[model samples]
Target: MSQLYASLFYQNEVTEIFSDRALVSYMIEAEVALAKAQAQVGVIPESAAIAISNIASTALDQLDFDALAVATGLAGNIAIPFVKQLTAIVKQNDEDAARYVHWGATSQDILDTACILQCRAAMTHVEALIHQCYRTALAQAEQYRSQVMIGRTWLQQGLPITLGHKLARWASAFRRDLARIDAMKARVFTAQLGGAVGSLASLQAQGTAVVQAFAAQLQLSVPSCTWHGERDRIVEVASVLAIVTGSLGKMARDWSLMMQTEIAEVFEPAAKGRGGSSTMPHKRNPVAAASVLAAANRVPVLMSSLYQSMVQEHERSLGGWHAEWLALPEIFQLCAGALERTLEVLQGMQVNAENMQRNLECTQGLIMAEAVMMALAPHLGRLQAHHVVEAACKTAVEKGVHLKEVMTELDQVKAYFSAVQISEIFKPESYLGNIQDQIDAVLQEAKGEAK
Candidate 1:
């Protein structure tokens, strides 16, 4: 374990979700559930189910990896070696019971259901961390909704906007992700059970009953069909995870830009010996953003592989089903790490309301040009007001004076209103049009999602 890459990509909590031990544990869980399900329907002896369940609870360390590596590679799946070991272990306790260890299930059934168990565990972690981002962003938005800042478009400051509005936009993406995860839980948690091909011909009359019992034991939704070759549920989970990572990447991108020494509109939380420059002592980098962006860049490739691999050969697949074995775990690991790191970024983020104000001022009243045009619009026609403001902006810049001050010399502005209105136009507070209402609606919707 390179603690460095582990530190970077695999948070201790998330890495555990995709750990070798967890894989074996979940596969054993599926096998035991299958044994119980079969026993309930008389396909397997009750004594055999008890014996297999008892042995399946053995420690992960007791499993022989050297034998499993060669055996599973030949068998093309983990459940084959796992069931082999499980049945042998059960034989030690009850020789007759060992015959029913795996009952009528195929390798894909146990493996697929085991993978779903891992997904449920990994998603549980992802969901908690995402909720952290949503709540933190909500508070920041609500706190700063009226706090004026420079609103930039295409990397150029175009108008005055509240910090709350910017934070609310970030929060909105997480809301959709949260809803997606909730909805996907239904689609992705269904159990996969088919013997050899899509038909449970091995189990004959008892297949459906055993599958229902198996799903009940695992607390997973029962599949409508065998789904041995159908992998859309897996694809759907990966697709939603891609959206989640992409959204986190966007948040990181925004924070990274804002953390620029020149921008300094926000800062990732500062800590001792953290985000420090090894060579230059004066730097505090947005390191969390780097990890998030990297995950964002890499996850789509894995997701695309899943999409391409969805076209499996009839009933079973050649390399297509095999392709999913490693890709799905990696997708979960990378995306889970991104969620965790992003949650850290949001929780510790330093909002520089002062810097926001300073950046808004750096525009030298040009950001308020729209405000001036609109206020003058009611008095003068819209086209005339735009032309007047355009000329006034040029004069203000050329003379190195404020836009409000330069407007005093223009007769078009003087004819429209008093000096007070011109001064008000230059103030950011005068131009926040409906931002409060917009932000309020977002906050309200966020609360609704919480319910």
Candidate 2:
């Protein structure tokens, strides 16, 4: 079922990078680790370990997973049928050794190991996609670093800013999220082995050794205790996924807004047949951005359920773990889809620098009020300067005159600055302070850390 959903919604390049086949291989690897742990604890004979290792090393096709699934009810699941099949394979020549395949471990030990492996694989794709998106954003920022546009606050034009500066902010957010995911690797890949009741009493003397050996075999960190009941790790993964998707969603929303016909400062690529609304033949809608926003919005709701599921009872809460099983993969798949589409949208974006500049002058220099006010602050008291600027702006709006014309009408405004100074204040380049430098810093940091 997980594989089907992933194939349907996540059959993109990123999904291919972290395929379910790899996840199944990881599950098989965990089963082999369990067999080895049993052997070290004297629960299984040395011969059984050798045989299990040999069998696990072979292709998954070597085992009839379909038959095993029916036999042990492990279809569309990982751990149970894995153990059952390994036990069956081990007992083929020595029936007595079948009892040792699972030994003191519960299903979660194997399941959690498999999940970590899957996460590790998925993280590889996540990291790559994040870097790609950040690089694209940096490039876009550099291209429009000085491209002036109106900055809106509360849906109103509040100031003048470069489009590059805005894009740099989005890139910086992605860079931070990538760092966070890298930092979480150690915690997320830790082993899970709390046994049936969050205790290793069943293994007694060799519990620690078995856990260490199991972690070594699977190439994961050995946790201090079984985390069957403590689900913070899963919650953390979900939260990170949510945050990354949300950032991309914000970018998508920005694109959607900018591509509005009345504000066509930016647009997605004009695909031959894409984004066509049946009723509007002339529409080149921002469908990629819209899809990304929808994916991002839906992911948070799934992640919210994951957060709520953390309050589980006892050492092994089927309710909580089950909730995670349902929510985690969906989050992974949804996030993958969003990232894929976001990358596509950004890489092929149609940046209208000409329109951006034209729109910068759309309000006839009213966007420069702050600049005008700041220039007048030294000559007038700050409050008095603000009042003078505000009154001029109001008069300009009512009279259909430019703010500069209204400024020319006032003796106080003339005494504060000349026409050249006013023109410099309205220049878009002056307002984009350190925006490119910030992008360079973020890109450098991301590259250094990724390496």
Candidate 3:
């Protein structure tokens, strides 16, 4: 029933997501603010609040959204026609009271409320997906915590690390992003109060109370002043969302690379009808992961425009606000979809522990050079030990012999450690110092936050 994809990508389904129903909620809050402002100043009868309340309670389906859309263009936003319709409906019942509907407010008041309301709704979806992805990442980390694999520094094998360690890093990054979202709630949920320009000069003495009451009615926090020209909050929120999605994208890209046939370290599980290439019958692709990566890459670029839109002229600039109106919703929806798909991909992931171990040994004990060097440090000086290990590693590569074997053949290496000790240096498990502890710390923090 929800046309999320259609509305976001195709720009169809006008009354869905950021639609009339959503804007009507904003209008209701704006009308309440107006009535409260008027009542506080004794400008309008308190009875008007009750009348406005009743009129505003009408459903979105009762409004003439079609004519409003056709008349104003989607760019007109639903707030203008919304106030027009609300005033018309109220005036038909009581002509005298209709004048009090929008008392001291301008279209920005209603539009800003509607934008935040849509953001709240969209964020709810995004938060759920983020949590889902966090859970999947935690599970994957726990599942493969001890599965040893070759670690690459610059696309070449550098050391040995457990698959779980790699996954736990991903989990940790997402967890940090989740904490950021929680911390941003106060900043992001604040109500906008710019009237015509960036000041509340029209409301005179009752301005602050009206703003607070309006925010209370809408379940949002009131800002100290109007934000007509202060778009930093919007930019901040957009940047965080982009950062969160970007983390997911990084994970997807890594997974895509690891899923390469030459690597085969991990694979996203295939569904019954998923990942089929058009021409290749035997092809199983990382399509979902790739999709997540692509979406993540696009979110930041879209959000950057929001940041750029912050440099508007004093009071108001259609250039800045209108740019936001075009960009923010799409960024939120795309990021939400990317996060959702990332969670789905991770939840059904296939981790190959055997392949991880196999790859860890693929370098013929060269992956254990650091461990060997560290072991020899107590006997040999640090530089001397490193040179010896480096030479052994080079000989192993050039002569096609194992590093441990080369080390055993050397009298210097044998003097430092026995053959058995040399063999122990190459065991991947010995090199996993603090990795499990790090994972535990991350998981503990996540669990504590969840509680």
Best model number under lDDT: 1
Model 1 lDDT per residue over 1-451, tens place: 3666867775677678777778889988988898888888888888888888887777365788788888987887878887888777778878998888777778888888988999998888888888888888888889888888887899998888888898898888888889999998977998888888867888998889988999999999988888878899999998998999998898889889999998998888888887898799999999999989999999999988999999988888888888887788877878888888888877778888888888988858888888888888987889988999999899989988888888867888888768887787788877888888888988999777669
Error of 3 at 116 (Å): 1.3
User: What is the lDDT, from 0 to 100, of the residue 104 in candidate 1?
Assistant: 74
Candidate 2: regions farther than 4 A off: 1-24, 40-43, 62-78, 93-97, 433-437, 443-451
- Model 2: lDDT of residue 248: 82
Residue ranges of candidate 3 with Cα displaced over 4 Å: 1-16, 19-21, 36-43, 74-78
Model 1, runs deviating above 4 Å: 449-451
lDDT (Cα) of model 3: 0.78
For each candidate in the order shown, give its overall lDDT on alpha carbons: 0.85, 0.77, 0.78
Tens digit of lDDT per residue, candidate 2, span 24-138? 6776778778888777767678787767777667746566756654754434445667666667766775576566667788878877778887777787887888888888887
Candidate 1 deviation (Cα RMSD): 1.6
lDDT against true structure, model 1: 0.85
lDDT tens digits, residues 287-352, model 3?
A: 777667777867878887898898888888767888887788767766776776787778888877
> Worst lDDT window (10 residues) for model 3?
6-15
Candidate 2 lands at a TM-score of 0.90
